[model samples]
Target chain A: MRNIIVTGGSRGLGLGIAERLATDGFQVIAIARSQTEVFDAAAQRVKAAGRGALQFHAADLADIEAIPALVKAIRKEFGALYGLVNNAGLGTGGLLSGMNDAAMAQLLRLNIHSPIALTKYVTRTMMTQKGGRIVNISSIVASNGFNALSVYSATKAALVGFTKSLARELGPLEITVNAVAPGFVDTELTSGLGEAGYDKIVRRSALRRMAEVEDVGSAVAFLFSDGARNITGTVVTVDAGNTA
Target chain B: MTSRMADNTEPSVRSTILDEIHRIAALHNKQLAPLTDALPLMESGLDSLCVAVLVASLDDALELDPFAEDENLAFPVTLGDFIQLYENAAA
Candidate 1:
């Protein structure tokens, strides 16, 4: 079975993606600082159902310098990484003026630097193996923009460029790179909006409902599937037409 | 620690660069002409992406990238100059 790495897989959308991919029969190695009970349960579900296995590894992705070693160690544990989900990121929302220097620095480090550095090492393995998939978890706010998310949006927007350029760079090796831009999903990441805020968003969406974490997960899984082999250098927006 | 040996001799460093050029070429399905010290990297059949992979892999193997530390360093054009850059950095 092909091995995949899902960063931030302890909870939220990352865990959802891990569960979905494991259920779809890809050995998923979920990298997070700590494993959650919810993540453990999902892993158990996949295993008990005789689906692909879901396992966990610990890493602080914010430390960009340590990423090369981290990728090396993970590759040693799980042979020939077939896919990477750059899902670990901070959604610290704040207006650009009020955001302190430290907060801005922290946001850039985790949101932008970590994924790019991680991809650098991961793609080495992929380039050698001659085929792989990379799905970067982007936010719908990246394109449409949102209140109090100027810096966050910029970081996510950077991933769109990262995804497109990397897709072109690695295309010759048969590696596919894509991004999934999800609208406000029902995760803790969006819980800050609370029920009323989500309801307001739901009313605005053409679907008249907020997207579930599973929807984002399915989009990522689809990209890793054979059906998306030819799909590269594009952003797969999963916002349920909220942007539409 | 493995790179410590390359610090002892420039030839060993050159050998590492040559081996990596071959490995990267094969991985990308590019056919490289026989390597020589005078061969320009551009003529080696490895495109920019492959050259990037080669540089990154060498940095990992040697644990030192002179180019990363010095922005003003002249970009190496020949296969020999690339190996020398790493050897000098290791020294």
Candidate 2:
């Protein structure tokens, strides 16, 4: 059976991606810092689907040193990796000037360093087998500039560059690397926007609404399927035409 | 060649791979040096971008992955080695 790893799979977009992939029959291993109620329910649902296995590992992604061990555990259980989604990331927005050193460091660690290290470890496995799919969760801020997300945007943008370069390097094998850039989504991250902020976003968007988690999740699931076999090194915008 | 072996498919895996190489190079407007067993691919005008597309297209047609199950794989450096890489896996 093919195996996939979705980081930050306990909630929001990560959970959505995990559920869709599970429904599609790919064994999913979700790595979240904690096991929340939603995660347990989703795990049960996926297992009940009986199409594939569902497992969740609790670990802090920011602890980069723990990555190798996590990969080892995945190999022990799943044998090989068919897909990896670097969906574990932080969402922070503030003017660069106001951002403190610690916050910037933390953001970089979670947003970029951890994913790159995980990708490195997973690619080592992918190289030894049929290639796999890597979908890095990015944001519209990665492409377009935003007022308070200077550092956050920079981190997201870094993944775009990394995706393209790695896609070419791994093309000879079975693997493909791509990114899904989502605009504002109605997850807990955006829940703070409240009525007025959401109204502004809805009005400015071409689709007249914020994205749901499934919207981004579906895009990720596509990249892992044969339909997107020929797609690589490209950022698929999942935002409601906001980035369009 | 035995009749039993000939029934697998037409064009053979070897020719298929060669055709794909030429096709990819042509599609990308890359001027690969004259095909040869000893020609180094790096100097053959096949840029990194071209190689990426070539590998993906070839992988689509020929599913054999030489590097699979072995990370220490000495990746093919020449046209012959590259062809042999897939052929070895197929065998």
Candidate closest to the true structure, highest lDDT: 1
Evaluated at residue B49, the lDDT of candidate 2 is 56
Q: What 10-residue stretch in candidate 1 chain A is worst by lDDT?
A: A121-130
Candidate 2 docking class: incorrect
Q: Clashing pairs in model 1?
A: none
Summarize candidate 1's per-residue lDDT along A96-120 as a digit string, tens digits.
8899999999999999999998998
| Over 4 Å off, model 2 | B1-91
Error of 2 at A236 (Å): 0.8
| Model 1 misplacement above 4 A | B1-16, B26-31, B56-75, B85-91
- The TM-score between candidate 2 and the true structure equals 0.73
Worst 10 residues of 1 chain B by lDDT: B1-10
lDDT of 2 at A77: 73
DockQ score of candidate 2?
0.05
What's the lDDT for residue B45 in model 1?
93
